[model samples]
Target: MSAKVSPSPPLYTTFLVYCALQVAFVSFLFSYYDIEVGPIIQPVVKWVIEKAEEIPLVKRTFELLRTLVIGDEVNEENTKTLKKSTPKQKEATVEVHPLDADLSYLPVFSSEQLSFFDGSRPSKDVCLALLGRVYNVQKGHKHYAPGGGYHFFAGRDATRAFVTGDFTEAGLIDDVSGLSHQDILGIQEWSNFYEKEYKLVGLLQGTYYDAEGHLTERMREVIGLIEDAKLWKAAQTKEAEVFPPCNSEWHKDSGGRVWCTTKSGGIHREWAGVPRKLFNPGTKTSRCACVKNFGPPLSNYADVDEEGTRGDLDNPNLREYPGCSPTSNSCKLQED
Candidate 1:
């Protein structure tokens, strides 16, 4: 006899039965054990959705359904969200100004205007000018105010007097004409000191700066002189290293004495040289220097082929003391 086959249930009916069983199992856990299944299943469902989004067909299908249900608002919100998440490029801006523009943002003061701040006026601040730059010296009112020791320096550009030690009206002038390069360098140092110690107020409209607060031709010349002075000072330092100065001591009753040592003139070296008078070029002044007695001169060390056994003792710039021997390391100074 032929057996009759039973028809299978529909797929939708099977799915519904499986979902109902899962719901019953979750409800039993929640009621009997006080456990919730939503928290554990939520992350898993979200991960599955994220993975499905990677598939183009699934992603497009979901997007189409979402658009039909939410309309254009969702698309506009997504576009705005995308814009917020992305970085934007900044626009470039360029500004042009004249060469003599007031770039320092400091005020320009005339000599007459600067004179008001000399501590004479009770309402004004104590101020002074150096190298065309004005500095407020109110903090040092004791020294810059009226009847003070440095009162003459207030309210004026006394650049020349800083090095010359001349506090007279004629000497306190800003005119630094005919001053030596060393004097210019000294003025520069004083300017640096004021800049570091006090607050810069403005530019002085005088020899160093114009009415517009720009550097003038005289200021440029002074700067050039300062540069030359710097070079000269550097060369002098190098010469001192090569030929160290002698140690000297003076007494009222006893005579003065100058001697040489390996550590003289704050220069520590291996050689204890003999004393000699080193005359500065184009100047009548001279200083005692220690002369090396052996090997090539320190300045000529790079000349490999240059033969010298007497060291710097034979240098033309050096001369022995009148009463001292050529090889002596010490000399007793004779008072003229």
Candidate 2:
């Protein structure tokens, strides 16, 4: 007997079977990975779903599959609920001013309360007050703790001792009543230094600040004095630039010699000037300064004309050395 011949399936039928197997494999992979196929296959899936919805039999089959897989009907309300339940990651926000600490939330500290943070107890922090502003100096515990060099300043507002070099119990008081304007300015500088180096925790209730952390009248007056001192310092700096201090050197056997240089007194200039004794008004005290000899004065004066060529040499405040030449840029001093 001849062997029976088997007929092959149609091309369309073979293609459909292959496609169904591929889709089943892809669906298994997606389900195992828990992947959201909506975004990856949105366009193709949407078009297929739309066409399937147009056919009553295909639409009913899809509804049956959806109910079996998701335990819900495919509708707009259910889709929105699914999206709402999805997890999302949040991004961190950054501060606009990272260095500036908001001090308004800090509490006002009384003198007795501030004394508790003096590092005497193991649980307490090392603290000190400058101009009524309290700072946590725990990082410098070796210097601010008990038996330390600066331990005396740790528990109190001893701003006066910063400039006076008086570390005695009586001299460590915060009252700056008899201090000069320069000393007040010195206290302000110490406050600035503490603000930069440590954390400001609170305000003290005496002298500079009130119980409510408001500035007292005495503090305002001190601020005004600081401003005036700054102006006076600026004028003195300008005067030094115009009339740079003369370079001086002395030896036991050779006496002394004062000279001028282009870079004398740490002030750089194009001219190496002549040395002269600059006198302070209403005082016999004098110091040597380098004065320009061939140009107009660096500063304006009521008695001297701007068009003069004598520089600052013609000013009444300056006098030539007794033994030195009037045009020389150096002077040899003779021991009296």
Superposition-based RMSD of candidate 1 using all C-alpha atoms, in angstroms: 10.9
Q: How do all models score by TM-score?
A: 0.65, 0.66
- Model 1: CA > 4 A from native: 1-105, 300-305
Per-residue lDDT of model 2, residues 71-183, tens digit only = 53346568898899987867643222111223435678888998898889899899998877788999999999999989989978998999898999898878887776678
How far residue 183's Cα lies from its native spot in candidate 1, in Å, is 3.3
- Residue 5, candidate 2: alpha-carbon lDDT: 70
Per-residue accuracy of model 1 over 1-336 as CA lDDT, tens digit each:
999975564664455445544443454445445565578875654565465555555567556655554565678779999999998877653232222335356798999999999999999999999878888999999999999999999998988898899988989988888887778778777876776678777889879787777878887777777888899889888998988999999998988999999999999999989999988768778999998889877754433334778888767778889889888899999767
lDDT of each: 0.78, 0.78
